[model samples]
Target chain A: AQTVTQSQPEMSVQEAETVTLSCTYDTSENNYYLFWYKQPPSRQMILVIRQEAYKQQNATENRFSVNFQKAAKSFSLKISDSQLGDTAMYFCALQKAAGNKLTFGGGTRVLVKP
Target chain B: DAGVTQSPTHLIKTRGQHVTLRCSPISGHKSVSWYQQVLGQGPQFIFQYYEKEERGRGNFPDRFSARQFPNYSSELNVNALLLGDSALYLCASGYRWGEETQYFGPGTRLLVL
Candidate 1:
């Protein structure tokens, strides 16, 4: 079974600064997908960014970008110019071609300071 | 789009009772999935349905069952509820079963006594 690992349990970043949350996964499948999801206190999960295993270029979504290393099986999320609204639990998830179910990491609590 | 919508923002049941949770997928989405999120843990996949057919089944037991309707809406039913079943039930929808991106609903909090 594939599993996602988020090494950082908690992280803080000052307003307008940049912060990165680390995530790694183990998968034997060559074709897969990595994702970053922002889960606010309301328990609503929102997609931040996604990276395809075959793509060498990282995925970027507005202020959110992904550092995807296929060989290393590492997919990290970088939040630039962090805002107060970024304060939430960030989860790293992985999906394969077999199913759409996401295997999520434990999550990293990001606190954007004012 | 409305993303995904789940019914009964909150639910409470006793151990040995049964519970049902409903969900509506996005307007153009044809797939729906169910997940359980316990406090301080990540959401675990329960079931996945696409085109009104069961596409994936997670490691959950027989106590957890779900089905999709013709309209792409879905319902998850849990029988003989245990306190361990108490968690946040989340519904996510996608264009297809393995589309990679899933839009999630606000989730229904289930509490078992």
Candidate 2:
């Protein structure tokens, strides 16, 4: 079984600034994938970034990036140059390499203030 | 091309009622997954289907069930709904199964009274 944890329930960031959200997961399997999804008021689960457990390099996409630590079992997301549209609920998810289910963290609500 | 689509953007049901939600995956996608997201919480996996076959299931009770069609569309059925069963139902689709990225639809909002 895989379990994900997000320590912060909410976060606030100024527009154009940067904010990082922390996530930690526990799983017995060595091979798996981690993802960050953004859900706006519309309730659409939008993919932000993903990191492979076996990969040493962190994953980055546009203004979104992840700090992945394999030994620590930590995967954190960093949003740079945050915009008003960045305000949303962020979720960290885990999927095993051979499994189809995605276990998710509770989530963190982010508010980007102008 | 169009992304994943789900039917009945919003619904209202009473206790003991049954509701069926529909989802159409992206074109050519063969895998569809279902999730339930209660307000203020992250989405929880319910079921995953590939090639019209059950690939995986979550810890949900037997009250929740799902199936996929040949066209890769899927439906989630809930029996004897309870007020606690109210949630936003999400449908996600992937090009294949396994480690591939899954794309999600807007989701269906269900409210149980």
Candidate 3:
């Protein structure tokens, strides 16, 4: 079974600053996928970004980027130039090459202060 | 044009009761998945159905069951529910095998008393 861990239960960042959420996983499969999801007060889960295990280059989308260390099974999310709208609960997830189901980390609550 | 939608929005149930929650996927999408999100925790996979067939299931007990219709809509059923079932039950949809970005609904909040 694969398990994802998000050590930081909560984080806070000021507007225009940066915040990083930690994530680590245990997996025996070499090929898989990682993702970051955001759930705001509206309770809607939204996809933030994703990284393929085979892709050495980190994935970035606008102000969001991931530091993926394949060997250490670490995938952390970094939010730059944070805005108040960026406040949400971030989750890290893993999916094996042969599986469509995702195993998610506990969660990290990020608060962006204006 | 609308995104994934889950119905009931909120529910209240007593122990040993049976509850049904509904979900409608985005247009043209043939995959629907269900998840259970407890307070202060991440969502946990419950069931995934594609093309009206069961594709995958999570570690949830048999009390948690779901099905997808030919129209790509879905319903989750829980029988003999327990207080532990109190949580926000979310439904997500994707066009591809589940690898595609999943669009989630506003989840049905279930409170088992």
Specify the highest-DockQ model's number.
Answer: 2
User: Each prediction's Cα lDDT score?
Assistant: 0.93, 0.94, 0.92
Candidate 3's C-alpha runs over 4 A off are none
Per-residue error for B42 in candidate 3, Å, reads: 1.1
> On residues A1-114, what C-alpha lDDT tens digit does candidate 2 reach at each position?
789999999999999999999999999998999999999988889999999988999999999999999999999999999999999999999999886688899999999999
Of candidates 3 and 1, the better by TM-score:
1
Listed in order, the DockQ scores are 0.78, 0.84, 0.67
Worst 10 residues of 1 chain B by lDDT: B94-103
Question: Which 10 consecutive positions of candidate 1 chain A have the poorest summed lDDT?
Answer: A94-103
Give the per-residue lDDT digits (tens) of candidate 3, residues B35-110: 9999999889999998999999999999888988889999999999999999999998888784576778999999
Best by lDDT: 2
Residue A68 lDDT in candidate 3: 97
For each predicted model, how many residue pairs clash, with residues at least 3 apart or on different chains? 0, 0, 0
Better of 1 and 2 by lDDT: 2
Evaluated on chain B only, candidate 3 has a TM-score of: 0.97
Can you write out model 2's per-residue Cα lDDT over B1-113, one digit (the tens) per residue? 99999999999999999999999999999999999999998889999999999998888999999999888899999999999999999999998878788899999999999
DockQ, Cα level, model 2:
0.84
Model 2 interface CAPRI class: high
